[model samples]
Target: MNLLNMDAENRVVLNVGGIRHETYKATLKKIPATRLSRLTEALANYDPVLNEYFFDRHPGVFAQVLNYYRTGKLHYPTDVCGPLFEEELEFWGLDANQVEPCCWMTYTQGRGKFGRVSVTRRGAHVTATYGDMPGAHRFEWVNPNS
Candidate 1:
């Protein structure tokens, strides 16, 4: 029997950033051409001490990412920033478009230690700038409604 099609006896365990998760290959194979699917295909090595496949990533965020595959719904974590969560979603080969509009606004226009930002949010439309002043370093216009 192919490992991908393994039954109850073929359960796989994943250890992501010190967090252990038990899942079946079948559940992971739900979405093809993704990191999880590839990991499933590669037949990741099992850790004797942990008894799970080791993956170095954010455990808190991975929980949300895993839910996407399981439920086909992308739910962003409130505790994580939009950019970082988006990066993780990209790594998982998931579309950022699936995220909610409110999630996008979490980092649309903001100031940080590196630079300043000016954001214009008109309803669901968003225009943003990054740097010391508006239109300084980076400029982006996004219309989530469209």
Candidate 2:
């Protein structure tokens, strides 16, 4: 069989921060020149006993990274801070600019000259608080359901 056919059948296990993930080798190959695609070159991260590669990285963010490989659509994970997500993307050799437009605002949120702004949604209202200082700016608006 050709290498492409063989790679499609090959499976790879990745343990990221104690989370185990299984994916086809061909999926990783979708994005060449990436850390996941060049796993064989990183012998130090391989675990022979479990037949899996181990990475001492954030598991939550890694999920999004792996999804990008599988779907070719990168998304921002809401649970992670923007800077942290950017850092994870850099480590995985993925471009942060590839984040989907739908998530771009959430991904770039809290990154401003003033400081971080925490936003919360309640029913039809959206509330945003900027910093925790004594007279911090707080805004609340009703989001009309279209």
Q: Which one is best on lDDT? A: 2
Cα-based lDDT for every prediction: 0.69, 0.86
Q: What are the clashing pairs of model 1? A: none
As for candidate 2, its clashing pairs are: none
- How many clashing pairs in candidate 1? 0
Local distance difference test, candidate 2: 0.86
TM-score of every model?
0.61, 0.71
lDDT of 1: 0.69
lDDT of 2 at 37: 88
Candidate 1 Cα deviation (angstroms), residue 67: 0.7
lDDT by residue for model 2 over 29-135, one digit each (tens)? 99999999888834998987888999999999999999999999999998877778888899999999999999988777633423668999889989999876567
Error at 145, model 1, angstroms = 48
**Cα deviation of 4 in candidate 2 (Å)?**
17
